[model samples]
Target chain A: MLDNLQLLFVWAPVMNVQMILDGVFVGAVFALSAYGLALVWGVMNVKNLAQGDFVIMGGYIAYALFHPLHGMGLPTWVIIPILIVVAMAMMFVFGHIVYQLIIKRVIDQDMFTSLLATFGLSLLMQQVINLIFGPEVQIIDSELPILTAFDSFVTIPTVKIVSLVMAMALAVVVVIFMKTSRTGQAIRATAQDPRAARVLGIDTDRVYAFTFSLNAAICGAAGVLVSMIWVIQPFYGIVYSVRSFCDGGGAGQFAGGDRDGVRPRSY
Target chain B: MKFKSLKTMVVSAAVVASVSMAGSAMAKVEGDTITLGSSISLTGKYATNGLHTTRGYDYAIKVINEAGGVKVGGKTYKLAVKYYDDESTPARGAQLAERLIQQDGVEFMLGPYSSGMTKAIAPVSEKFGVPMVEAEGASRSLFTQGYKYLFAVLSTSEQYLSTTIELAAQTTDNPSEIKVAMAFENDPFSLDVREGVVDAAKKYGMKIVIDDKLPADLSDMSATLTKVKALRPDVLIVSGHSKGAATAARQLEEMKVSVPIIGMTHCEAAKIQEKFPKAAQGIMCATQWVEGIPKRDSMFGSASDWNEGFKAEYPSYSSVPYQSAQASAAVLVWKEAFEAANSFDKDAVRDAISAIEMETFYGDIKFSAAGNNIAKPMFMRQIDANGNYNLVVTADDMQFPRKAGY
Candidate 1:
């Protein structure tokens, strides 16, 4: 019994620390993915079931820019910002087109129909990506130096550490934009009470578009970060989608909302 | 005049033999592109296996195409691959098989990482009459299905479980009356593997101490580990997905139990190296393919090139799944057969494929009438401290008849 107690005392904390760190590292990526998903869900009130697919598309974009184009003598770091912008713009157009064609009509319909419809869209998107990319895992170009190691047992990856810093900064920027920018405020107002915002002469349609575009931009950023750390494939979107919902803590809840009651209302 | 006439007659006979050999060579297909289709788990839970296998195929294909593809029947053709994610679901796998056959118009197919998925996709291959070269998953029933279109590159589940048991039974230190315990996930694939282990144990005169199906999604494996510890079996066998496999290993380590774990399919590939790096050491598992197992070159020089290429990719001593590499070789073989048959007709291809003595990456492949390869060999590998598997004993390397018991 005493031996058992000694073993527990020695190993429990070590295991806990490992789990916690893993959770944090995984959770950061989750938070970023969720933020993108939440924006689409919160504003459009139509869950873009294909949100994860868009993330994978962004990763593929980065892969193409890095390789093949490497011969063009463009530095990978310099090309990343341009890739992110292009991914965001492409996804924005994709979302707008998808919403306009199918989701906009079914916004007030049965939730089941919306779910099925978006699911079909997701499948279509997955097939498209598979056709183009051939269902392969494309490796990232970025190589970050290792920051530290504890006798080879606990090594801190330099890329992940940098990603944590970048993620936090990105989060702060998004929060600040939501708090200050007029379009952002209008979108927030619409999310809080669309009927009320509509009465206040703020165009809810435009706000929806702006919110979706913003969500896509965030997703593209998350994809860029992920591409740096792990090999990206066309089907990674589904995993991202699942992890995003996990990090959201609950369905239809906002993790980014502040204490000042500036919460985005979700359907 | 009589001596000159005799010389002319001998020369004519030699020329006739040469013409027959040339005729066979000309029958082999050497098209511009040799299309190989893969229906793999790309999107769902088994994505890791599918992704790695696909990567292996891609890397292998790229290397082959760069070398101007396989030269057979006096022509060179490039390899073009069409692949789809089966989503790790049997239904999806079947659908993908149909799509690959009907839409992609591929000559050969490989993939479906689990046994159930492979079984599901087998019918599609049969229906379209396109030859399929399976990788990773294996079930005895697949070969028993009597389909002419099916050819398995990997060994059957029986071979894997039986090899592990055969290995465990020979442990010198634990030579008490052998008590075997079986813990596996509740799935068709894992169930088939457990059956194989049970059969092996019974055959070897070992007592069944415990046999239980752990839950399919057993995240917390403390209870299972505790039970295993209490049972105190001489040998404990585990089979399932990686998550459960790792959980079992971790819990066992935490409990300070020193029982040797002979693992099943869940611990087969390179992924286990990452999940249970410490526990993986000394844990034995049976597999049809291992990149680490050094073997002599067969009829295929291209197969050796793939081995070199894979070594360059993950120089960190990672275990490359041998079956996927075999599938890449199967693509080359199919090209050879297609050319030999000189027709895309299913029966013609099947006839030609069965007749040819295929020198594949896994070695010489000769199929039985049921389309199952008669010589599908499996290796029993033990993981080293560096998380790489070493082929300690293969079916070929086994000390004949018997060794000291567990």
Candidate 2:
């Protein structure tokens, strides 16, 4: 134990500014995905256990587009953002279909029911993704250059900085959409009081579907960013899921009583 | 209604007949064939290596049969394999091993790919009293269990990285001044590799700067790389299968953390040189077989000959992975034992295998009391300048270590 402490203290000076910078950049990606999870949980009143699988699926979509285009004469700067938008759009449609076929049934049920349902969905999606992509780990091959500082003690890839900017920009767009748009208002109203919103002639079911799709779009965007900056595989979905769940809880508390005045359950 | 019922009866009879025919085809030994059973990971996480292992077995069996089969008691018997997809799950591996022994009546068995799967299947082989020669599973803990029925042809995981230390000592005049940093995946195989490196480093009087556990998923290693950059260890060693190796290579390049000597396991098996040649160059790795070995035998001939035949048959097979070579050697060991025993009896074959000692194109085969290969020495290879592995160190040749650079 003494030796352990001594070692830790000796290594303490080495754990410097660069480590924190890396953690913050990685954590930003997690926050983006978690915001999506929180959006769905808050509006639809359903927990999506397959949230990470959706993210991976989106990553594969971006990879499918980027890998082929990478061999072409197209530049990464031209292909990456375009493919990300395409992936988000594709996931939006996928999420709508998923909600119509499976999640809609459990949306109004107890949290346990939705949990079990989405858990099964998560397993099915993981296997399907594995079959489609084969089990090899893949990266987007963004070919973005690395940036070094402090005589190379601190290293940051340009792709990571791009991903952080994209994540923050998306989060801001989501917040603005929720505060302004008619559909977003319907979603917030339903989350505030579904029975009252139904009595007010709002199509609560459509609102739920739209909110779920929007959440999936957000996840898809985050996944595209993740594919650009880090490595992804079929089985690595659960780690992202756990990270997002933690982020969702923290974000829920921080934003509590500001907009909807509803306390996020202690998930 | 009566005519429909008759049709249904005829269909049912045809189905039963087909089922029985399929079962009989698998069950029959055909008077001139010896069938060995295995539960390989054909469809799961270990599928890539599992494919290599199975193909090795197939190629070896084909070669043996073409060479007039195994002669036992003046009768030649062709070799056949009966394998099931274990799905890379231990429980499934054990279940299939039992099925192979009891239901299929296989007299001999071959082990699975990973050490975990082998550990699960070893007890079943012991209980059924069938001798198994395994090539892929290398976890040292699997040997210490004292199971007599199980044997592994590959060197134990503990020996995987000892040669890196040895290579370091040969390259440097002051070996004690060399500092090593190791990051190993916290799995059975990698943990064993860590143990080997630590022991070997101590023996060579080297200093260990950082020893960290890579998480199971191997998703992130930035923090570890950051520390590595600061400490600037003389050598950086990683042992986390293909994914871990890829992570190390990619992250090392991204972080610009260059060590003088970089050694890793599974650089060839994972095809890292082909995938990321820029990052892969100058990285030395431990392997079970190299192509230019002088060892030869009647069944497989020399290493180059075996590789040529394998590539001719499998045109897309770029490099001869160690998994396939060791797996083919496992079959050769079985053939040698069967021929020496001069009988098909299980007890006689087991005895012959226990007392057997020989060298093949893959390597030497001599099992210790713990059923691990002791005769074969692991060699070191470096990814050369042209994105191909060059044999840097063998039993006969030891060269200067290349420094890691872009």
Candidate 3:
């Protein structure tokens, strides 16, 4: 036991700083996906179990653009932003279709029904993605250099730094849009009380559809950032879903103390 | 109305009964062919390696048939395989194995792609008293259960890193001064590899600076790599599947952690050399078979000759991964056992396999009491700068102190 203690002390200092840096970088990606999940759950009142598959699908979209476009001699700067935009646009349309085909039926049902429906959707999406992408692990080649600091004890990849900044920027933009935009106000009103919002001439259905699409767009952008820095697999979406579910639960607790005092249903 | 309905029901029941009787009369095994069954992961996470394993099985059967299939008791029977897709799920693999035996009436069994799947299917073979020759499952724990019917052609996971440790001890002037850091996935195969390395490290009097368990999905190894950089271990080893290898290679390059010798499992099988050339270079890995090993057999001929034929047949076969070679070798072992036993009876064939020992193109084939290939030795290969594997050490050769590229 004393020998084990000696070994533990030997690794304490360096492990602390290194692990903290690693956690922070990885946590930023988690925060982005979580925020997207919170947005849809807060507004639509439908628990989407396929949230992680959406992120994975978005990552594949970005991969398709980056690998093929780079092969065609397109510049990295030209490819990265285009990849994000294409992923978001594609996911937005996909979200709209999902709402029309499945989410609409479960929108007014009990929470358990929605959960079951979306869980089935998650399974379907995983198989479809596996079929299309061939189940091989893929990582985007950002080709970014590494940056070392603090006498090389702290090493950070430039791609990760870029992803962190992009995540923060997108989060800030979404927060501001929710605070000021008309559609965002309608979404908030519908979440507070769907019947009242409908009586006030707000189309709760349109608000739910738009809110779901916006959530997918946010998750899709996060997926793009993930592809740039980390590895992606067809079946990796469930991990993201579980992480986002935890984050969304925490966010719901914090939002429970809002001025409106509308308690979010816990699943 | 009652008389007409009763007559219709009786007529339908008679028709169904006749169909069942005819189906039962159909022969599962004929005088001309002997059938073996397998549950392969043709479409799932293990799909890529599963394809390689299945192709290996097919090729070996084709070659054996061309050479005049297994001659048993004055009769020659051609070989055929009946397989189902397992989707890389253990439950599904077990179910398919049961179906292959009870429904398809196959006498012999072939192993699945992964240790987990093999663990699931092994009990089914044992319960049915069927002998299975598996080529891919390498977890040492699989053999520890004392199952009589299960046998593996590949070396166990414990031998994966022993050669690297031996080479490191020989190459380093002061063995006691060596610090080794290892991170292995928390799975049966990887845990066995970790045990092997730790045991070997103790034998050589080396210090284990850091030991970590990689998560199930292998999402990140930065924390482990970070400690590795600070400790400045003389050698770094990681044991996992393809995903773990890719994660480590990517993180190592991102962190710029350089050690004198880096050894990892699955570098060749995963095609890490081609996928991440810069990060893969100078990494040593253990492989079951190398292309030009000085071993030959009448069945598959020389290693190079087999490789040449494989490439010609499978034009897209980039590299003869150890999985495919071992899979083919398993079939050859079973064929030889059949001919030696001179009977297709399960008891006779099992006895022949238990006592049999020979050399083949894949490697030497001799099973220990645990039914593992004890005579065969794992080879070590280093990924060169040109994104190609250079066979650094055969079974007996030792190349130590790999040059100063991390």
Candidate 4:
């Protein structure tokens, strides 16, 4: 460990830049998923343990698209962003169905009940994914050339840069949507109090469904980035769920509210 | 509508529970069939190699059954394995072994995948006094346990990639000045492989550089590669299972971290050459058996013949993995032992397995007192530009200073 510290600090200090680049690439993925978790937990008050599974599910969609589609003589850069959008739209619909079938019932129950329900959903999604995709470690190779710096010591894949920009762009779009859109206002109103929003003529059920679906869409976008950069398998979801909660809780605390009321306002 | 959905879920859960209970109550031997139980890594981290080992067992079973089956006590008995997914965890492996013996009523046993898995199942099989011949799981510590009921058909893990260190020493003019970097998984199999490398490196008075224990998931190691860039070691050796090989090959290429000699175990099992042909070129891969091993039997013909048959069965493979070859060989050992014993008695089969000395397409299968296949020697093969593996026996056979095109 000491030798490693010395090697990084003394022998090859330039490698520090390479390590940080790797962190930024992975961090972008975590941030997107975290934002999704913050949205759902803040709005619906549903402790979604299956949030990570949504990310992995979205990654599978990208894998199904980018892998076979690219083989049919299509370019990667053109297909990647399009697949991300496609995954988000598909997951939004899936989340709506799930909300109707499962989440809608649990919303009236206590937080513990919602936790148990989502935990079961997480397990169900994992096994279903294993059956569909098999238990192999899959990656959607973007085939984009890597850029190098400082005499090739600091290497960066072009896909990671694209994923970072995509993540930032998605974040900006979400912030703007939450701030100005009429549906976004209803979502915040419902999050503050469903009874109050209902009295004000906002359909609380519709607002809850929209908020949950939006969170899934954001997670789907993060998952597309994961496919381009790292490897994904069925059982790797639990790790992502943990990170999402961490980022969500951290973001919540930083905004100074019980359930991050200030951040949910800017959701 | 909600009531109907909940009712459907409840009924499905009941059906699944009942089906699983029925699945465990299979017979050991019934109506001209001999059942051997095995807990394989059908899911989890080791799933890739587990599938290869399963194919090996299944393909061999098919060949043996077609070739008049195993003739024991004047009755021909078809061989079938009752497999349970151990999920690449030791605790699960042990539980499945007990369940295979107790609930499944399996008298004879086939080995699970990997040394860690075998270590877990061995104790359970030994307690039940069931004779087990395993193809995977090559840790030397397994052989030291004095397991009379256990027999392994593959060379120990210590011999897995130690040959690369010797080759490195031979290729270098200054053997004493050789530098070695190792990244082994924190599992029993890889840890033993690391010990063998440390011994080999010591003989040449080599300097030990970066040594990292990869997590069980074997997910990310870009940090290790970053260290490799700064240190620039003469030799880089890695061993973890198939996932480890995939992660290493993926990151090594992505980072463009090149070394003169880089050796990794399970490259064939992972199909690194086929998946990432450019990055995998010139990388040395260790194997238990190859097509050109110059061995044959009437059952499987020659090593090349077995290779052809396996590729025919699983046509997706560009090259056959040694894991499958050794797995098929383990099944052959069971057939031989069952015939030699001429009885369905567990102790008779155990004695038969211990006294066995046979030759097949996978190579010579003879067990030592400790129950490891001391007859076979592990070989190192270099993946060529076209993704074909060519056996590299000596230092000169290697393409020095690996050029993994960044």
Better lDDT candidate (1, 2): 2
Q: Candidates' DockQ values?
A: 0.07, 0.31, 0.41, 0.53
Residue lDDT tens for model 3, B244-272: 88788878878878787888997766677
Model-by-model lDDT, in order? 0.64, 0.82, 0.81, 0.87
Q: Ten consecutive residues with minimal summed lDDT in candidate 4 chain B?
A: B19-28
Give the per-residue lDDT digits (tens) of candidate 2, residues B119-160: 899999999889999998899999889989888898889888
Q: Between prediction 1 and prediction 2, which has the larger DockQ?
A: 2
Interface RMSD of each: 9.2, 2.7, 2.3, 1.4
Per-residue CA lDDT of model 4 for B317-387, tens digit only, reads 88889999999999999889889999889998888988988888998989999999988899999888888
Residue B356 of model 4, lDDT score: 88
Find the candidate with the highest TM-score and give its number: 4
| Tens-place lDDT digits, model 1, residues B200-298 | 887778887667777544433444444445556667777765545555654443334456544545564435555446555667766666654444333
Candidate ranking under lDDT, highest first, comes to 4, 2, 3, 1
Give the candidates in order of TM-score, highest first.
4, 3, 2, 1
Worst 10 residues of 3 chain B by lDDT: B395-404
The local lDDT score (0 to 100) that residue B124 gets in candidate 4 is 97
Q: What's the CA error at residue B124 for candidate 4, in Å?
A: 1.3
Q: How displaced is residue A137 in candidate 4, in Å? A: 2.3
Model 2 chain A poorest 10 in a row by lDDT: A254-263
TM-score of 1: 0.60
